[model samples]
Target: MSSHQSPFTHPNDSSYGSLQTPDDSEQAVVSEEDQEPGPENADTDSTFGGSLLGCDTDTLASYITDYKYENGRQYHSYRDGEYWGPNDEHANELQDLAHHMYLMTLEGRLHHAPIVNPHNILDVGTGTGIWAIEMADAYPSAYVVGTDLSPTQPLFVPPNCAFEIEDCNMEWTYPKNHFDLIHIRELFGCVVDWDDFFQQAFTHTKPGGYVEILEHAVTPVSDDDTVDANHFFTKWGETVIGLGEKFGKSFTIWEESKARMEQAGFVDVVEKRYKWPMNGWPSPQHRTHGDDGGKSWKRLRELGVWNQLRLYDGVEGFMIRLLTTVGGWSYEAAQLFLAEMRINLKDFNTHAYLGVTVVYGRKPGLSRTASTETSSTETGSTKTDSSGFTVHPMPKSNFPGSYRGMT
Candidate 1:
């Protein structure tokens, strides 16, 4: 599948989820009926190839297109049976670890240099709004907004925290020459357009304001042991890329963020890559992380995969089995893999040389910056190196991108 824009980017594997029906299972997955295309156009495109039922793109869109805000905080759901969650939103090992990592990013700002007079901040595809809520508490002076499509968020939140139910792939609604910082984490590889997304950020940002993005270098940056050519994660990544191209997204938008930001007239763009060990390994750094970090990594793996696994359930019949059965290994194996992943999360680590790429840029002080006018058509492009892996930019302008690219 070319990384060109389309709507079949991710796969759907729910057919087998129903096939594994136990005689006494309680989660009544309606096997006979196909996915009803939510509240929108459920009546239209009702049939798959006029009769079949697999990988219903329209249906998936309708299912995830709800984001609401109330009080001060935000909320979202992990599609219980589909992908991840029915579990606690906050206070989890993985979320806690994620929070810790986020806090590290905030140290320079939160405790060291207090954010003052900042006009606005954005949390793209804010899942549970946990990060935003925390930031809201930390920076009560700024208006922090989170956007997502699911209304499964909390009705009450921090005084400064607000949520919006806007599809980021569409036209951004914020005024131009606004916003101080835009923080988006974990939306890499799935964002549809890097150019437009960065362009809007540049336009909205107050020239010196920063835009920080934290994303895992999933290609597995390693020192001693590189990611295997045929590892499960690699294969899954390829599958996701193929599916993303089919679904109007590229699903591999991590590599091109810096370039896109530069193109959008951002300056002082800096990239920080870090190795994340799969588990606390033989190295002292790994030892320091210990079980405390390992458990958090394990949960992250489970949630990340589960969150997007259901999208494939619509097309591939055996897909559900592949993910839940064979793909679902014992906890021990996950621990090992996660250990390696964590070690590799950083650059030039003693244990493993793997790391995530943390990139940020300040919007250019262009006096005549272009306005955020959404694109009418979706498009994409990517670059690759010696390895089979490649990177593409996910530009989110005012609109004309996938509303659910990062969902």
Candidate 2:
């Protein structure tokens, strides 16, 4: 296991004091005395209100087409049963919310890979196509392509972005050595053979291009031991893990992705981990106590609320089909289990959090070697290396960009 410290401060820390209930809107508000001096002045109200299940009018104009109905939920018809989650309005809304949570987690950066001015980018399993659209806008010079099993992406996308309905597990039709960066997010339990997945990624990536993956741990844990083995959340996690094993697609792939990428001939593989508090349990006092990726106490509190909401919105979509088909549980039995799990999910006192890991690697070539040699002094400036690969300095903005208003 990686020795990365949990970004959360211990629950027993005196600064945290006691857990408090969030406001009726499910937003956490800290008194001025508890807040750290910072430049962010956005309202503390939850961004989740107003048209909760609504999609952008310009985007997703045809998201309701060609879905298979199951247990009152909608699943993708193409390669149906290949994936466990649903594709209906509720599920799509949850996916968009999850994307917002990821933006908050990453502190506004779309990806952690160091690649710059990528001319060709790909997003694997681009649910709802939110991230791909953002990337297209971020890099107007790059032509972004998003692939998925369903045509759930927006019809009205940027000119530089396009969506393809293709099952990634099958043989890829993309030209070999094509993409500048391949981004894969939250595909846990959707892939049967990760070795083949990375191999395809390696082959399709241009020499010196990068492949980046972002996945969250299915199981929730507590640093202060507040959630024990017998907890309902723990039991739910164990059930999901066992179901994945029976389904022949393990949910624990995030742990082994780095090694798989390296085996696929990718080099300079790097892994970064983060925490998503199950609810608004962490207080403002924790701001000074731990490594929270430099997020403010207010930001962490908001992230906690959003994380909890996304999980609550997604638990049934994540488990229903898997439990009934793979685990052989009756629909009623699965619903009963999910009810218990949801109860634990709403408990702020538990102080549990899910782990998010990002692993990235580069295809080896002279260009990649040249990228390492380039250096930049200006923030957010782009520099071209000897082999024509652009190197961009990471942005340092604390405010979440582009999607902040949508959140």
Instruction: Pick the TM-score winner.
Output: 2
Q: 20-108, model 1: which lDDT tens digit per residue?
A: 23465565565446655563333234343222233364355444532222221122332312221222333233443454443433322
Lowest-sum lDDT 10-residue window in model 1: 1-10
Candidate 2 displacement at residue 220 in angstroms: 0.5
- Report the alpha-carbon TM-score of model 1 versus the true structure: 0.51
Badly placed stretches (over 4 Å) of model 2 are: 1-65, 284-296, 368-373, 377-407
Q: What is the TM-score of each candidate against the true structure?
A: 0.51, 0.77
Tens-digit lDDT string for candidate 2 (1-407): 11111122222334333323456798657787787744332222234212222223212323324577878888987677889999888999999888888887786778888776678999999999999898888888888888787767766788988777667788877778888899999999999889999999999899989999998888888777877998877887798899898888879976788889999999999888777788888775432234346566667677788888887778889899999888889999989988887788788778787777889999997444324456533334566655555566553323446544223
User: Which residue pairs does candidate 2 place in steric collision?
Assistant: none
RMSD of 2: 19.6
